[model samples]
Target: MGGELTWGLPVILYLFLAGVGAGVGTVSASVLLRGGGGGFGGDHFRLARIGALLSPLPVIVGTTLIVFELGQPSRAFNLFKVINLSPMNIGSWLLLVFICTSVLYALAFLPSFMPEMKHLSDRLERVRRGFAWVNVPMGIGVAVYTGVMLGAMPSRPLWNSPILALLFLISALSTGVAAIILLRAIFRRKSADPATEQGYHQSAYLLTASDVMLIGFELMVIFLFIMFAHLTIGNMKYAVSIILPGGDMAMMFWVWVVLIGLLLPGLAELAYVLPRLLYHRHYAAPVAVEVLVSIGVLIGGFMLRYVIVVAGQVTGPMGI
Candidate 1:
């Protein structure tokens, strides 16, 4: 374990941002599909609009960071030169296609803001739907690829588990949901129309509920991650110990990733959600609470990547 690490903050940011973009794109696509003939405007599809408009920038920025990290901007194109089953090659292509499709998907919703594009946008409705379908899997693929990239390195026992990919995917989604909620909270307008206000509340409720479920899944996957490593023999068990109680990364992993990232946010959301879900109470949450919970989840998400990336490097090259 050295004081200096090989892969630094840039890589961690790349992973976190990429996951967020993918998650946002996937959630946006799902929301669009769920709306059926509702299209991409109005109170009902506000979340979709937020998601579609927001998904691509983070990925593009994250990808740029990786390119710079490579020390040669042109090196990135090498991945696209040949097609292979390698995770790097596949991820390169997946990211390229996803960026293009997500941008086009966002364009489809431009009619909402630019009235001049309404006619052209209307003509592309079917194409827009097609992009949505493509986005779901492409977004998912990018998310899963993040973990698979790490897991592919067997010498880094901390990242070698099969469950790692699932963990990353779930975290990506949870954080994505958090991003959308945070944006909605920050920019959300109070509709003077009661019906429209109710629609806004409903959208917030659904996003909150979806995040709660994703947090649950992320927690479960994390538990399985720990158990998988703990149950294994040799280097992996030792690697797992570093993040367990009293271990090197114990406080960071438990406090940041579990408590802050998942539990507190989960409990807060469940508190607001249960009344609406069971007792039929109003579903409105204070803007302050939404902001705090969303920020917490995003912080936790970044820390999770930080800990995993740093820990894998620290614990490894496993006596080869």
Candidate 2:
């Protein structure tokens, strides 16, 4: 492996999952704040509730994966010692703060599920609303930090681009929307009130529309990332080669990341959304298609992090 990374799958998974955690947290907070005024079990509340519930799990799991992958998991806590300007220092604190706020945000939804806790709903709503403000900036920090952590690794030219942070941030939000849609679809299998059901479909449409635009932006960022590297000389070009036509990770990047992850999902969402927008009618696609789109987005998100991590190692600094 020489001077290239000893880091591997665990690191990639950590990046993907961390982005998911941050993404969902941001979406959950935003939805809670902007959606209609309704009580705990109302249509508007269910989606946000699901998102809040999920926001913490991925981050905690990703953090655990990285910590355990270290030879000594206990030493992971040593990161707390330095609170300086370093990316690691800032990211460490960011992740810690995000985890704490996300947990509180999730807990704030508890009263919604418990009829016995009805009296506490108002107080919980206030707490949850307060956390939403905190979650947005923290979530963005966490998402951008994942890429910045890689960008800080100058020895790996592929990971050193300034655009990587924005790319990951966009992907994180896209995947987060997918995750929420997937969960909402799964949990709402049984029939409900027509109005509530209509609201659910409408919400999914809006989210899908947003995700399509995000995917478009992601594709542009990726192009810029490649172009930036392709224009450089020597090792930088070598790094870009890993994802070009015959490069080692070409199939993964072009086929999985670009095709399945970004393009297909965007087209699928657009197909469903364009008609609804044109006609002013509330509509959603078949459940199976939505499921596939969500799954594809998630698979694409995972492949992106994996390919970037692996390719960065395969084409890195010249000598051991």
Candidate 3:
């Protein structure tokens, strides 16, 4: 069979990018809302503001790229004209919701500094609070649906699994949190408020800590998933060949996907954690490490979707 996947690189990358935006955007919104007096008024609050502001742009652009994938852009109306339980159907709707919510979330933050919007911003904040409730579940649903879109097809042995959605969902959260931490770190170093510096550092550490936990879980799932697929003696088992011991895509899967993407970030996180846990040790990673970890996580997150989408399609169809 031809090595054509239902979803192509553009769509897959689009999916990964959108999930990151939604996850990070929502996290930024929530962080802003949660920070009380010291929160928005403090220097760290500015970082949160920046995160909430910057995080949504990628998602908006990614959604547009997904549209450009069509040979005939005008026919895009066909999608809106039909609705079903299909994974793609669900994903499209979720993207629409995520896009709207993210925009509102970012705008709600304008009043914190924008003097012009101060009046409307108060009411916008209340609306945003309502959306905050909506964004969490919606963002999570979009992340998981990305994998579910690929996983729903039983014919693609490499894609079908309960764990696929779980992996995507967690990756979304990890990237989202990472974006916030990295953005805060950069902004803090550039700013001149001692209070802001401390706040940014504290926020970065907390978000990074959460990211560390999620990344660890994603690693374990990958291990168990490969093991489970390898042990089974059937089409499902054969799918494992693409990445396990030896296969066509093994190098991409192992080195870039696993090592730089997952391991580097995971190890960076480990380095930051181990000294403290075992020896009462602590180290403030230089800005370079923080930036590297963010880049690594983002790459890993996208590569995962790429691998899942491409590898699943490259395999023979059901060995029929």
Q: Highest lDDT among the candidates is held by which one?
A: 1
Model 1, span 147-246: residue lDDT tens: 9999997788999988899999999999999999999999988878899788878888988999999999999999989998989888899888889997
Instruction: Write one digit per residue (lDDT tens) for candidate 3, span 1-320.
Output: 26456679788878788878877866765665575413335534565567668767878888888888888877876777789999888888887887887777777778878667667766665666676677777778778888898789878887787788888888888888777767755664456876655565566665777788888888888887788877878877888788875787788778877898778888888788667557865446678888888888888888888887888887744545
* Candidate 2 residue pairs that clash: none
Enumerate residue pairs that collide in model 3. none
Question: How far is 219's C-alpha from truth in model 1 (Å)?
Answer: 0.5
**lDDT score at residue 127, model 2, on the 0-100 scale:** 90
Instruction: Point out where model 1 deviates above 4 Å.
Output: 35-37, 40-43, 115-117, 317-320
Error of 1 at 58 (Å): 0.6
Query: In lDDT terms, how accurate is model 2?
Result: 0.87
lDDT of prediction 1:
0.89
Evaluated at residue 260, the lDDT of candidate 1 is: 95
Off by over 4 Å in 2: 1-5, 37-43, 318-320
> What C-alpha lDDT values do all the predictions have?
0.89, 0.87, 0.75
Query: lDDT at 31 for candidate 3?
Result: 64
